[model samples]
Target chain A: MGISVLRVENLIKRYESGFALDIPHLEFQSGRIYGLVGPNGAGKTTLLNLLNLLEEPTEGEMFFEERRFTDLDPLDIRRKMTMVMENPFLFHTTVFKNITAGLKCRSVDKKMWPAMSKEALRTVGLKGFENRYAPALSRGETQRVAIARALVLKPEVLFLDEPFTNIRQRDIDLFEKLTKTINQEYQTTIIFTTHDLPQAHRLSDEVISLVDGRIIEGSIENLFEGTVEEIDGTQSVKISPKISVSVITEKRGKVNISIAPREIILSHGAIISSARNSFKGIIRKIQMEGQTVIVNISVDEEVEFTALITETSFKNMGLPIDSEIYLTFKSTSVTIF
Target chain B: MDYILEGLGNALKMIVSLDSEMAEIVFVSVKISTISIILATLAGVPLGFYVAIRDFWGKRAAITILNTLMALPTVVIGLLIYSFISRRGPLGVLGLLYTPWAMIIGQTILAFPIVAALSLSATQGIDKRVEKTALTLGANNLQTALFILMEGKFALFSAIIAGFGRVFAEVGVSMMLGGNIRGFTRNITTAIAFETGKGEFALGIALGMILLTVAFSINILFHYFQKKRM
Candidate 1:
């Protein structure tokens, strides 16, 4: 926890098709579970592969434990780090043999195999399946065995790619509990890729959101409820699901506008308002729908917008449909894209 | 038709009575085929392993050639060995023609391709995970190869049995190369050919019974291996 376990700077991976993965920067603190959230084709697997040293990054330096990962031997890197893909591959053997396969290769003490195997099985809640054939294990059990195979190594960093996609429906709770126990007990740094928002939120200390192979939002709590756009030669950001202001007049590089909707306080109609610009628009349609009254307005024959107001505000204005209204909003709320 | 019945009866009687001469021919056939198949397996199994796992230039061509050889006509191989062992042939000074050694050479060649090609298919047909998982589990090259080969024991066994079966039942190579001289190179297949052609149906049928029994035993062994594997 005290050291920066994984340090990735300016990572970019290029595919044969010329598509590139452009992750500006990423850092994973040691002994913490970091969730990588992205849609399909967002380079999540590519990023994981690079981290596992299964593939080389096109451009970027990756560091693990203050040592450059590219400098490590491939076998040494594999021995230290383990990855469990969505579909884990199991050998065609009895469960006992499959579990002991890795250890057998390294030639672990023969007496230790049983104790080690029993502990691993119990950790994954697969207690009574020691002698069963690996292929006959249930899908969840198979994954658990795969986990056991890696867990036998006791890897420093475990990278899981969509760890719970094919988990049995009934084992979801068991898996969550198992992960929490492993994280708490082993203090293992778990880096998992998942698309389930709630699962990520539940398991992750930090979530990185990727879109179109770029990090649009890298932090969990930094989401902005707005659609970004450029208008009039300047990048402007418009907050969505609300229409408070409309354009009034256009100048060379700037525009003047008035606020619509009585929701904005007009203190004397000339007093300074938090809203920098306001606009005037003719009310096009007004009706009561689903708990709120819908008010559609046309501003300057160019922009159309909608605003929600309280029923009390609607009655106090006593305004009829198709009437003109003034709207105002704060400049801070309108962030530049 | 009468001779066919007498031959069949004598064949059964010889097996039941365990005739010493008939047993001698059966023993020679088993020895030759077993030895030839073992040699073929030793030479061809590794070739199978290489063909299945390694990627290189001409690998496909090599495998194609081996596959083509699997169907090589037995008599053609007999003629080839005959030419090499005849007085005018290159190794004629050694005078190996009409000997059991000559038959062994011919039979080994005839079975080598079958063993190698089948073993290649068997090894190649193994689950891809078997190798990848072994590698990912920290196995070095030799360990991974050995691990995969161990998992494919049944297939390797089948390949060996197939080679043995092919060589044991084949007559063209043994007859042309061994000359079927009695009390020596005359094996079960060659003995059957000679006895039937000479109107000695009893011995011919006796040899046929022993050969069929050997084939049946190999089949049973294969079944046992398969069951044990499953």
Candidate 2:
């Protein structure tokens, strides 16, 4: 198996302006696209700069491919890793010169220039614009040129800072297609910072969400799908399924009644007092399946509850299209955070 | 005004005819300015590069000194050099005063600070990423510095032009150091001074016209390089 490609440990950076980044630990294995999702000023760019060694960290260690990377020469780090900044700077030269700047710096084989340029341009769909002036390119085209320059170096790892930011939504498809091709073809380990949640969901194999310079939710899929319930009367909230018995929020009187379609228990009468906040609502509608029943209740004209009960339960209650039934849930099942 | 017209006509006629006397003065001006610019660039460009790139102790003091030197009065410099090279001074053994060499030395000293200070600003003005990018590309420190200098070549040229323009138009240094020696040490500015003092208005105006042309050419060259960089 391949070695873990990049590892960061207890990275901390503080500015005199009172902003700080305190990431305890983060790692990325080879051959995966790790999406770094956070709000603006959430330290995403700061983390990228630290990883790229553009700025020195205030404290902590970092490693690349099992080698100790802290205190390494920044240029050496840059040789193997490339970052495409949100707003890229194009050199005052033709596209070809800017793309070839890195190769020339490293004194790579001069004979390979044509081939490398061709491949890099093709990778980013910029094949015909080789001689164009860098300053004259549109924002999207300039970004592609920047990508081509970074990719042409054939860096082992690539960090993109909001690569899709200024591109129009309609052109996102084309951009995504190019990204997929580059990832598949180069097998380059990729880490990118973006606030586009849907883009992260579609492009990343794993998403790490950051808040206030801390990792709040990490690696849990469908995390937002968990129901958010405001605790009765406090500044607290909890997430849980509807049928939980301990659904009591920290506050006194408010709790959300949630039930998974599969977890709901339905009855024709108010049968038990052990569960709190049971409500009587008519089945306003019934949708039958092979062995399941979907009962939609109009708790109010606006609020509703949907429960999936077995056909047996529905039959025994003689639950027809307009039958009244009771919905029950315990408070203990609530998840308080 | 009529003398000015006649001087302009003579200036055009001299340029058209490639007259040797006029040629000699123009040649001397270009020679002194070019040599001084080269010396200043060699001595000052790297100094500026170092000052801009490094964060050593006394850096602020050094920058402040350089900035102060940038505004140093040309006549003051001329007087200082004049004292050191005079007949009764320590260097009188050489008898080298009132020559092109003395003028060259004065002009070089006059221009060095301008080039060095401006070069420093140019280097300092480049994006920080450009430096980091060069280093990350596996370039050693010297190589990285050279790369940045190449990228900032236009700014460097501007610095050199500003230096030459300062030196070439300077009358104080040329007149004092070279003693306005006719046919040998007489540059455009010194010649203009000499002709005007001797009541040769036509000759002084002709020299002034030539000075303008020379200054114009330098400006055109500076802008061309700037445009290429952009």
Candidate 3:
């Protein structure tokens, strides 16, 4: 709905350890919140580093505001965007100095530093913390200072790499609110990476799912890597020791499969169904994402599956936590890659 | 035993009275070591930092060479410099031998490898995120490098102190290069060596006490910085 602020074409990054990130195309619009969802080693952080210009792609062209990245000075471009790492490393000095680090680098007048830093701190709900030493702050407070440091620069884009990892729930709620405020007030284009599916859907206007360095359609929930096998004239993937899902795949050997959360039907009891795959599971957790209710069910206490349903269906079904349930899906719904 | 006790007593007396000769010796030793360490730090810190952050062919080999130099014997450096600055040597036209300048040059060589090697380790020990954080915050390449140096300041301070300690206690380079010129180039270590050989036990013991105190203080400061870094 907005103008494109960043676009990547045919991007690729290769590491010495044989890990490679390949993106055919991607675009980020201004004034929009985008969430990158992936598991560990899924290249979420690598992509963020490339988009933030903290790294050079092994092969690709990046465009910012229709201007080619190679045509612009990296420092100048970086000043327009900033990133807060998951484990933010604060400078070994006063919080004030850390918050004003960017401004100092820009050669801003010394007189305006105090007021600017104070204002930025206030935005993160950390007023009156200027004199405190950076290394002495608590984990949550250190993250807040790091956010304030990035905010003080008034960057056009903000990248948060797993900002909520190892954070308390209360702090997570606060950070979510802070992210929204920064987007709404400053119209900053924000890109954040997380492995939490429900959180990603709740926070971003668009969610990009990544698996093993490649982007894929649909939510990343219920993704499993297993071996394909033909057992008794049926083709299924053995996801776990106690769980197997029927799939319409001719390929064999190790493979990855994903099931769309919405395609699964939940039932209170095992019933006759036309679906090819059905598993009895227990409700592990329930979450609300807008009008959709996300139910997490564990099968045989070994494999967990996430199913999405409308709030009305969820309320009518009256499913309780820890209750036994049956989840059924069509063989065609299980996507193998 | 009586002679040793007498020497100890007279040494304490000379120290308490601030004997002029003892003071001159201490001053010269401090001045020469301080200058050499300063010069070494100026040259070594940046060299070490540059090597630590950059990837190049033979980088490991370069670091190995610097580590090897840290253990170089003082007399070897003295002999090496002696060849260059001695009469009829390549640098003999400047007449630098047997002067305080020659001693400073030799001590600087003795301290260079220690400072550079330790500084390399110090810079390498810094968290990798520090550089990324600074660059993401809009710092230029030079600023980012300086920011990392600032972050590793404690370890670097310990490195420079270690260099000072090595040069301050060395007698071979000072004796060979400085020729132990009294009131000019003679220092605590050379004075202690010469006076003890001449059987002037009081002065020798007094200077030895001073040298130990200085070395002890340097170690305390070094440990303090090392603790601060952690």
Tens digit per residue, CA lDDT, model 3, A59-142: 989999889999998888899999999999999999999999999999999999999999999999999999999999999999
Q: How displaced is residue A236 in candidate 3, in Å?
A: 3.3
Each prediction's DockQ against the real complex: 0.36, 0.28, 0.90
Looking at model 3 chain B, which ten-residue stretch has the lowest summed lDDT?
B1-10
Alpha carbon deviation, residue A121, candidate 3 (Å): 0.6
Q: Please give, for residues B46-98, the per-residue lDDT of candidate 3 as tens digits.
A: 98998999999999999999999999999999999999999989999999999
Instruction: Estimate TM-scores for all models.
Output: 0.73, 0.76, 0.96
Model 2 chain B lowest lDDT segment of ten: B131-140
Residue A62, candidate 2: C-alpha displacement in angstroms: 1.3
lDDT of 1 by residue, B193-212 (tens): 88878899998887877778
- Tell how far residue A48 is off in model 1, in angstroms: 3.8
- C-alpha positional error of residue A308 in candidate 2 after TM-score superposition, expressed in Å: 20
| Residues A61-155 of candidate 1: C-alpha lDDT, one tens digit per residue | 88887678778666766666677777887777788888888888788898999888988889999996789999888889888888888777677
Predictions ranked by lDDT, top down?
3, 2, 1
Q: Write the per-residue lDDT of candidate 2 for residues B58-139, one digit (tens) a residue.
A: 9999999988998888788888888888888788777769988888888999999999999999888776667765654446
lDDT of 2 by residue, A1-337 (tens): 3468888899899999888899899888887888888778778888888888778889998898877785566567778988887877777679988888889878989898878988899888889778999989998888889889889988888888888888876556776776677778998888888886557767887787765576654321212223434545423223333322335454433422334445456777787767664667777878775677667776544346667678887777787766677776554432332
Error of 1 at A135 (Å): 1.5
Off by over 4 Å in 3: A228-235, A249-254, A288-292, A310-318
